[model samples]
Target chain A: MMDILSEMLGYAFLVRALVVGALVSACAALLGVSLVLKRYSMIGDGLSHVGFGSLALATALHAAPLAVAIPVVIAAAFLLLRLSQSSKIKGDAAIALISTGSLAVGVVIISRTSGMNTDVCNYLFGSILAMNRIDVYLSVALAVTVLFLFILFYNKLFAITFDETFAKATGVKTGVYNMVVAFLTAITIVVGMRMMGAMLISSLIVFPALTSMRVFRKFKSVTVCSVFVSLACFFVGVVISYVYATPTGASIVIINIFAFLLFWLVRVLMTKRVAVKKPGLVLLMPLLLLAACGKSETAALPEGSAAQAAFVLEYPSQRGEAPAQAWLRQADTQGEADAATPVIEIKEKMFITQINDIYLNAGDYIGKTIKLEGIFRLEQYEGRQYRYVLRYGPGCCGNDGNAGFEVSWQPRTPAGAAPSQKAYPKQDDWVRALGTLQTYEEDGYPYVYLVLSSLSVLDTRGAEFVTQ
Target chain B: MEKDRPKDPQGIPSEPLILCKNLSLGYDGHIVLRDFDLRICAGDYCCVIGENGCGKTTLVRGLLGLISPIRGTIAFGAKIRRTEIGYLSQQEAAKQDFPAGVYEIVLSGGIGAMGLRPFYSRGEKQKAEAALMRLGMAGFRNRCFRELSGGQKRRVLIARALCAAKKLLVLDEPSAGLDPLAREEVYRLLKDVNRETGMTIVMISHDIAAVEKYATVVVTLGKEINAVGVGGEKK
Candidate 1:
């Protein structure tokens, strides 16, 4: 373990990762307390998506990601603040809209752009392992600025967070203070994005604040405790990632989750133990238990044994179910089949199959004869040629699952007879299309293609996915 | 009855300390009070009385230039500087376990006077200490604001307001949640400050009995100034 630690410390990238992680954790810990107190916990998530889009655009244009991301995130923060001010849209709704929309736009742009080696997944999730000295510097600078601002405005911030009208009446510039907070939040998201990734970044912003609040009472203590908790999580995560050779970002998030659970469990156990000594403690036991159970259930699981165990624990009945056995049915006998039916020779055509399983090495079998299922997205560019994108509607396809792929094909029928060429199937409509496999280059990137021989729409309706 | 009414102060080019003409106050566009005109003079201890949402708080806010009136001009006297206005809102129970000390909260009152400068001066610190001393909160300065009882927090907030203001003071529901002894103590403190310093005071309260006893000028607000009583004289 020491050898691995020494090796990790020797690498400049690893040092950068450690420094950036610690800085981001500190900054996030301080700001996150206010967010949690205000019940605007999702602001971090939304702003991070805005940052992701900004970074992608900057990368595509060969500009500095931080420069582009900072302004964009600040603008998004202001926009969110403005939207939240409106009586029509509540706070969470505005956050969700901006977050999802920005991420969607980011993914679409990334899909179209070339020559940019930036991985969408890494940005969405996080890549602390890939940090450089510049990233470290940015994070440190941001952390110090946030810390200074926090200290300078500590009293006013407390006053406003608790009660805005009172703060304003007492001569605090509530509007300017709020704007400063929003700006700080934007900076924190942009700085932390490299460490936490857009998706899991909010976890860093939320988890430590929540855990600290469980133990600490005062705002100052909460900020201090949250920073300590976040720093501990970051260091432990880095060390564990280095020792286990796991993804650093995931390792960090998992460490936070573990700490959260441990804190929650300790809280619950203490409350229960206290109940035995004092009956008044019994009143708090249920709340404590609920909090502990809630955190353990909600904590993001790592992509290994821990996750598998959590999945099993969540669905015990499903876990006990036996795996399906392959059937050994008898093959059709030549004597029973009126054996001498004349065989018709059919021409072998290249067909493209829908992506049934993206989790496997299905790319090698792209041009091979394979059967798959998906919905059809039809497009018209030239005469009577029905070009479509073959897609599968997975649960949370855009957010979590790699749901669909693009496919170009021509229907067998002449104009007007082929499934209303202008009327494309709505997204996530289940369909099956038989097509020949063809490799082609579009915008300087090779893609597997399927030329459709036949197509039929299945019974499944438009996109089916559960949303929280 | 019209002939017996007091003549309106018409054609007075110079502004009063607070002048509201045909003003309306409300949340959104819904009017809570209409056609309300009030004129407060320098050193006038104006106590406004009404039920919740009856525009008492709104009137106080309007006078301070925090909220714009829907349909009127709110003019302040030429001598009345904007920074001279100090306001204490209804005392909310501090989350009892908050981290900041009483001195820290009290010092926040001087933030506006300091403008955007990074640090506080020694003079500003001395003034904050003086304000706390005046409020009888000198010993509790090091104690956390969250650790104080209901009345202590009020006194601390009063110190904060004192630290902020140069001349005028506005308080909203200062006696709302306090016991009778605490409420009387607050009233006495206000009376003593006004007598000694000659500072302009405006307060919002529902305590009709107390306002009659303590207010120099009592303004009862609803659709309009229901009555403007001078000292103990009923209108």
Candidate 2:
């Protein structure tokens, strides 16, 4: 492994890849925190698509991608800024429209042109393993320029981001600053496109910021943490990709996600333990009492004390009828004694619901009965988990929007786990679940949650919950 | 308002510092202001004011040669070199997330003055630093523009504008968002520059309160020129 690594590192292309990757990662990381804070993570993704169109146009014209991509992307960025300023469309919608439209134009243009088999796929997805010396030089120069510009205009930029109206009043050229930011974002995206690809570039712009948010509070600290996390993830990802012969971009993204999960888990566990020991833990005693009513006294209470184990789901049941009860009947035999127990159910095919104040004992609920119904999203390798959202909805089936949440199952596998359901549900697939609730410590938080024992896919039309 | 005039070898009062007659400003074909006549004698502090979007900015754009007037001729006095017009646009907030320092931003002000010069020189550096010091921003010369508070940033921008101005200064909304104290400081700085150096200062501001305190002459606009005053009194 050492010999192979040494040989790989010795190659100019490999060295270039490392340098360019580091530079782009560092620059993106600096801007990523602000993007996430502003909830504009998708902007990077959109710009990447714009960069793709520019690259295609450049290739077709037999021009350097940097020369062509920079101006085009900058123009698109300005256009996007202009469009966002208009009240006719919301910012995200504008971004989506431009992103898709530009990419489509790029695809059509590429198909029409001949002899330039530029492997646009690599730019779309990323190809760090194939980086060359020119790529490194360009990336480094752009990164340095970005850093220099950012530092020079740091105060002006900060004022703009924090409050544009206020900044404008203070004699800061808010419009010019905004234009500069858009221009810089374009530069970073163009440079990074070849390594991260359009699809995953936003992840590079988001994950590091999220990880840093877990550890840092001040804006300066957030930026520092973001750069550190991004560089570390990229380096580790490159090594792993080399060792395993996986796609470099995908490997890096996966590593970032893993880091995010690790941070999230640790935070959760720490918060949970702290909450348990705090005075507030006593307030939860009543819920525990209710949960303990059915279970044995010494049945090894989960993270939540027995007194806090009771489940208090605030599901939006129509006319006070629980949707879970209806789904529970479908999971069990027709005459099961407890099948008649009141469970939450949705009478309307499409409606929003909020689940709050839910209490369960992590240990005792591990294999206990649970019936949940909502949209289901399954992660690869992880078995079917019940996904529900806390959201507001319009009459019956209209305009359902939600905050994101997911529930897991336990016993590692229930008594009758069938072949994991294929046909991964689409964006909004209505789902019902009959599962045993389980509790585990992710990071440091003790979450008492349900694990799906059985699940049924409901008709898709009623799936109105939109996740944030 | 002509005073003592220095003569060139073949001098003719060196022409009016700035001459505009029947100037018509507009966008596309729609006219905003027309048949407007104005002149700035050397070293005059001219303040232009109007209701929001009532062609104040358009006039500034015209003065800076950024926009063309539809039906007018604008002639600069021999002493009024085009490079002498130092324009400080309304404080545009920098993207705080950007990683740039104050010194670099101040340096950019020199871009106009350099006029395609390939590189910065030691003289330019000295000039930039002197400008910063003049604005009392020497201590913050190395600070990142984003890290500075609103007041500091405004001062730095003022410093930047000064760095580029050799004879004439034009500012847009120099005190739009500052607190009372910062606004006063800005006015004081403007006054000091005008008093000590006799630099021409032209500015547009919505703060009517500062008219009596700072403006040498105020030009108020409406469908036409509403009033022309000196020290807040109708002339």
Best by lDDT: 1
Clash totals for all models, in order?
6, 52
TM-score for candidate 2, please give it.
0.50
Q: Taking the tens digit of each residue's C-alpha lDDT, what string does model 1 give over A325-367?
A: 2220111122113324322111111011013222123344444
Model 2 chain A poorest ten-residue lDDT run: A348-357
Give all candidates' CA lDDT scores.
Answer: 0.65, 0.63
How many Å off is the CA of B235 in candidate 2? 11
lDDT of 1 at A194: 66
List, residue by residue over B1-235, the lDDT tens digit for candidate 1.
0111122257333235777788887667877778777787666677888767777877777777667778888787787766676778874734543455678777767666655665678887898999888878899977756658778888888887777766788998887667898788888788777666767789888887777777777888765575464634543
Predictions' DockQ, in order: 0.17, 0.03
Candidate 1 DockQ vs. native: 0.17
Q: Candidate 2's residue-wise lDDT over A14-101, tens digit each?
A: 5677788888888788777766765567778889999988888887887877889888888988888777776679988999999999
